[model samples]
Target: MTSGGRIEITGLTKRFGSFVAVDDLTFTVEPGRITGFLGPNGAGKTTTLRMLLGLVSPTSGSATIDGTAYQDLADPLGTVGAALEATNFHPGRSGRDHLRVLATAAGIPIARVDEMLEMTGIPAFARRRAGTYSLGMRQRLALAAALLGDPGVLILDEPANGLDPEGIHWLRGFLRHLSTDQHKTILVSSHLLQEVEQTVDDVVIIANGVLVKQGAMADMRGGGGAVVRTPDPARLSEALAGRGLTATPGSDGELVVGTEDLRLVGEAAHEAGLPVWQLSRKAADLEELFLELTSGTNRNLGPGPTEGVA
Candidate 1:
């Protein structure tokens, strides 16, 4: 039997007055997987999430968690947990108290509050007022509140914001554990593509409030430029270009060469007598592919509704 958490968005659209924030978006997030939701600023990602969480009404169509609308779920907070913003907590409330209030409101056990604080690594600081918490600490408190119900589905937007490197590493492992061990369905919206590439099992890309691409992370591999880490990236770029390959700046101080053939990168380095440190075809083309797909469509791709409808 299926473990149950599955998100289905069908022909979903949202409009703010005359502006089309999300248009005809459709995708599925399966159980036991981490799906990355990516789009540029003003891409309607926030609008869609709001509609899905029932915080805002959709202009048309539907967004459902576990095949039921979020508001219609027998236990809305218990079935779907969303941590959209870290700054929403009350400044006067302690972390433990904030979670306890949510738990009490949802009829969830009080014990889950402490468990979530411990699970999110904020138990020691649980008694501190939220106003004293750092941005990262607020983020952890928000996450602890989201998990207080032990929800089957998680929706996180920019979850890595304000997280240090060590915290990020912990989150990565923690999310993977949630998906793999607990079979929870997760949708993470992030502008940090490299971190998304490392953490997500699938990706759903959108632009101008429209679905652009969606697929398994594995499918994004294979046909990609080689991402090379070298001591001399300028020289390496020149070498790769001399071999008739175009090179571009990639994430993390790496040079991306346009060619799927692994030998081409190796040969170019060997020909230039340059010592190569690392080379791989994994996720090398994601940035390029994302830009290629959303380039001209990111800003006001098309008109929507009647102007000044609000």
Candidate 2:
């Protein structure tokens, strides 16, 4: 299979009447890694994915896979696989029948149906009617259908929505395997920051339909802040300042050191004869950062005829 290429979005914008759904969004998803596309509800995540897949046209700018728009790709299905929802299957059709129908439509061999069922770990329920399948099973079936073409890139929107802890664990490992072992480009859109935090290599965060931050997970988690507790807060703060370190008072009367190097703080405190009671490095958590970024944005609760009903 051809290796996946870069996916680029440039100045992508979408508007509906007076409301702008997506506003001047731009980012690149490189191959061979899982990039989390994260934002709170009503942050235009679904709209952005829709544009990327050519289901919704952007008002301005463009989204392209391998330097070509999704619709313009020569072999779109073979090059990109997407699982935006698991509810698209026919209720009456068996899971196997559902895949077989799609396979036939895609000109894929019938043998690939079994391959995908096994690959998705849903072979045991392949003959069951899709309507009777659990949410997790439906998700697995949807994923199998997406992989029917053996696409180089995978775009999944909330793929873990209905999965249990075990299923979520399985999905994390499966996605990493696809990126590291198979070299497939994967973009997973999710509002669950904690889940995505553990799964993705990099992240693109947005809020209020605008870019908030995008970078490697390491970079975001780096620059650890140290929390220090001492009997004499003034003395410790002075010592840290003497060493060119800014020490601010934390909420609980602890000193917050601005640097990740705890050794430096400890040394400064020891030299000043201020006995340290407690010291711990504060590693940044993605969920914390996400909440900080999108704190006041309107949350998209659900689809309804009236807004803010529930």
Candidate 3:
């Protein structure tokens, strides 16, 4: 595959006995950009990644790499590089040996192993046993293994699991380089919404085994909401109620104004003579937006999740 290979997941579904883990999921990840796979715990993010990698059999549907299943690809390692879990390496083997083993199995160049070690900043300690490494070191080793083939696409699940702030910053820049400079397709899964916001250009969110939203991050912020903080909570609540808006008390003395315009909310506070401590329009936070869509309660208040790719 070329550096601009694309990934397509079509109607993907997986079941274990009677329980359905993933259901009718469909989306595409384009090359030259990073796409974030986001969802809450038990939202089937791992299951979906496993299916895409052909590690697990899907009950129905399939995911493809450059129009073919991973097993059917001419050179799987050269086409798609993946790091699904942090502690997948053998404890007894040296970091360099671990990568060497995979490189041998994949028929990749042995020199690439050392290059990956150097690239991931683990070359100095490459001779040490992987079992002796710290969690952050293990994560770096895993990333090194993924880069061994210099593949056209990368599918990583929570790659920042054990990274420090500096490591996370390094990873963000590295992945961006993989996409922008190398023109590779990159799909990464994470529950860290803020991190994703900082790193990814596009996002695909799933919840309850369904697609919540998928689109460019810029379009997401266009759907706005307001955050209101008030001194007289009771009067503000009454004012909001009169205007057909709902208000739920949030942490501290702030209120999470659900489905209320900022100007109208300010107008209500002014008319009621309630002192407003804070009132401003908030650009939609993907994490908060995900909750509002899949949690069910937020839907009853107003027009819930944006129609298509919110």
Candidate 4:
């Protein structure tokens, strides 16, 4: 069985004419973990993926899998699988035929085609023309083709774009199976913040082709603040502000303190002589962190779980 590889992007930069598509970006995708690649529109996420796949050349720096560049890999298809665009399949070709063609080109066994079809849950409609299939079905077909070689590293971009809720749920479970059960390295880029929040074990966020943050999902969530409900919300807010903590207002007269330290809130409330009815760690919010990281500049977002793959 093939083994997964760590993805290392080192000071990668891409230039199209005068505009910079990717800046001096660097990050890593750990093996056996699903890493979410997130960025706003025109943030050079596609460019970074293209460079990593060797589809586009980097103006400077390099992207490597297990220290070997994609072009230099002994078995490219068997080592790295990517589905950047699900719509790249031929409209007239059957889904099974598409995988077969890819298998033949990659020198993979034709038997793997059926296996992938079954794995992707497209065996029932495998013979149907890709043009006749819905967007979600096409996504499944594309995924089947990508898995034909059983590559250790999987890269997907916006794979959930056309998926229904059920499809998305299945995708989450499928990716998890690949990562945990098979120990495959998966890097998925998607705009669905909520879905990304739920799916990925780690995240790499970029803005203007620059890396803004990258770390474990748990660390990101763990850095989140705590919620509190005090009778004197303003006084509590002022008290927290004096300690260099921001207290944002949440719904139903709740105070969202900017620290994960529950004891800090308790002590502050106690000192203020305020009756603290409730105080607890707020829910993990990847969206809020993402927005805050990408808002003003592409610079690193202050301090927190922004350190992982150095």
Q: Which is the leading candidate under TM-score?
A: 2
Candidate 1 C-alpha lDDT tens digits along 1-310: 1143889999998876666788899999999999999887667787788889988899899999867898899977778888998988789999999998888888988998888898999989999999999888888888888777788898998888899998899889988988898899989997656768889999998888888889998887656667888888898889888889998987789887888787899888888888889888855467888777666674443465542211
Better of 1 and 3 by TM-score: 1
Compare the candidates by lDDT and give the number of the best one.
2
For each candidate, give its TM-score against the true structure: 0.79, 0.88, 0.77, 0.87
Clash counts for the predictions, in order: 0, 0, 0, 0
Residue pairs of candidate 1 with colliding backbone atoms: none
Looking at model 4, residue 120 earns an lDDT score of 89
What's the distance in Å from true for residue 100, model 3?
1.3
Q: Clashing residue pairs in candidate 3, if any?
A: none
lDDT of 4 by residue, 129-240 (tens): 9999998998888888778888999999888878999999999999999999899999998655677788999999888778888888888888668999999999999888
Q: Cα RMSD to native, each candidate? A: 5.5, 3.7, 7.5, 6.0
Ten-residue segment with the worst summed lDDT in candidate 2?
301-310
Residue 107 in model 3: lDDT: 88
Model 1, stretches more than 4 Å misplaced? 1-4, 225-283, 298-310
- Report lDDT per candidate: 0.83, 0.87, 0.82, 0.85
lDDT of 2 by residue, 126-217 (tens): 88899999999999999999899989999998999899999999999999988998899999988878988888999998876788889997
What is the Cα-based TM-score of model 3? 0.77
> What TM-score does structure 1 among the candidates reach?
0.79
